[model samples]
Target: MKLIIQIPALNEQETIAEVIEALPRKVPGFTSIEVLVIDDGSTDDTVDIARRAGADHILRMGCNMGLARAFSAGMEEALALGADVIVNTDADHQYCADDIPALVRPIRDGEAKIVVGARPIRDNESFSPTKKLLQWFGSWVVRKCSGTDIPDAPSGFRAYSRDAAARMCVVNTYTYTIETLIQAGRKRIPMTWVPVRVNRVERPSRLFRGMGEYIRRSVATILRVFVMYAPLRFFASLAALCALPGIVGIVRFLGFYLSGDGSGHIQSLVLSSGLMAMAMVLMAVGILGDMIAANRSLLEDIRARDLLGATTRRRHDATILKLADAS
Candidate 1:
């Protein structure tokens, strides 16, 4: 088995080399270890530093596409490089490199296809009270959506087996941490978590423009994932909500009409009719959304097959070339 440690970098010229050099040179059940850096249009010397630190692969983007894009690119490159497992870490060096082995242990032992490096969010001193509350609330929401009991849903430290990597498709441009956990749960991928250590704050996050922007994007991403995967439930709940009020309105209208005040209850009839019409519309929308969700699932399957096939063919071609060289 081969493992590729991938770091998504923006402008970490100072810490990128340290992050790369700190990676484990060898791990059990892996024949080789390779370091990959995704330079997302870094204007600094990050690429140079990573190269100097002996990164086996560096994927440079045309422009700054954000962490999600850089992460996806690194995963694709790693898979194409015949990596059996891929470990992703931040370039800021906020996460401890020493915990990488424990992070990937479940994957190596065949217990999980994806492993999340859970961090002690409560014990972190860098987090403010508001930040800590938001973290806990966001993680709880993600757990409900993903059906996974992950403590640190926002942590970037994670490991994915080839199968899990191939199946990954990130639609959110803001972040991959939360969206991926939700996706894995909905897709029924075998995922687990391990406690990991983190270092002190090295630098401010470059991913978010500000706290408000981060909150907006995070909420949008969460809602998108929920609606995309559970459209029927989402729409049906709204439909039922409207229907309940419509039923109550109709009952009140009936009571007024039976009391010989039918003319006075005309407005109630109109309101009830409007509510019922809205309920019907929402139901129709729910069905349409459910159909679209099904089509999306089929597309995901096709994409996964394509990725797995490409990886397999790449490995096969490399093997043939090596045999020819030996001959």
Candidate 2:
């Protein structure tokens, strides 16, 4: 088995080397361990620093795409490198490097295909009281949305078994963490979480400008994923909202008509008809969205099979070459 640790770095020249050097060179349950640094169009010397710190692979992007795109690219490259397990961490070094073994242990033991590192949000001294409450609320919302009891939904520290990584398709440009979890939960992927330690980083977050911006972007991502994964339910709820008001209007019109004031109630009937039409339209859209969701699932499955097939063939060819050389 081979493990690849991937760090998506931006302008982290100051700390990228330390993050790379701190990684464990020989982790248990894997014969080879390598580091892959995803340079997301860093204008600094992050790539050079990572290479000096002994990074095995550096996948550089042409421009500064967001973390979601960088993560997707890293996963693709790691899979192509024949990684059995891929561990994604932050270039800011906020997560403890020593905790990586714990993250990978669940994958190695076959307990889960995806493992998330839950941080001590409330107990961390670096987090303000407001930040702590926000973190708790965000995690709670993600749990309800994902159907997974992950206490740290926004934590970037995570490990993905090759198979799980292959099936992951994150479309949200804001962040991949929540979108991926929602996808996995809806897809019924086996997942587990482990507690991990966090280091105190003095630098501000590069992902967002402020708490308000983060909340706005994160909420948008959650809503988008919810719609994508559970479109029928979302639209059905909207339909219900419209239908209830329409029904009330119609009942009011009927009551007036029975009381011999049918002429004045014609306006009420017209309004009710409009609302009912809206309800019908929403339901029709829900049906269409549900069909699209089903097709998306099938395509993901096909992509996963293709990735695994290619990995297997590469391994077979490597084994044949080794045998021939020995003979």
> Which candidate wins on lDDT?
2
- In model 2, the Cα lDDT at residue 50 comes to 95
Q: Which lDDT tens digits does candidate 2 get at residues 118-218? A: 99997888889998998899989999999999889999999999999999998987789999998999888999999999999999899999999999998
lDDT of 1 by residue, 140-255 (tens): 99999999888889989999999999989998888999889999999999999999988888466787767788788899999999998998899999999999999999999899
Worst 10 residues of 2 by lDDT: 122-131
* C-alpha-based local distance difference test score of model 2: 0.94
Residue-level error in angstroms, candidate 1, position 298: 0.8
Show the colliding residue pairs in model 2. none
lDDT of every model, 2 decimals = 0.91, 0.94
TM-score of each: 0.97, 0.98
By summed lDDT, the worst window of 10 consecutive residues in model 1 runs over 202-211
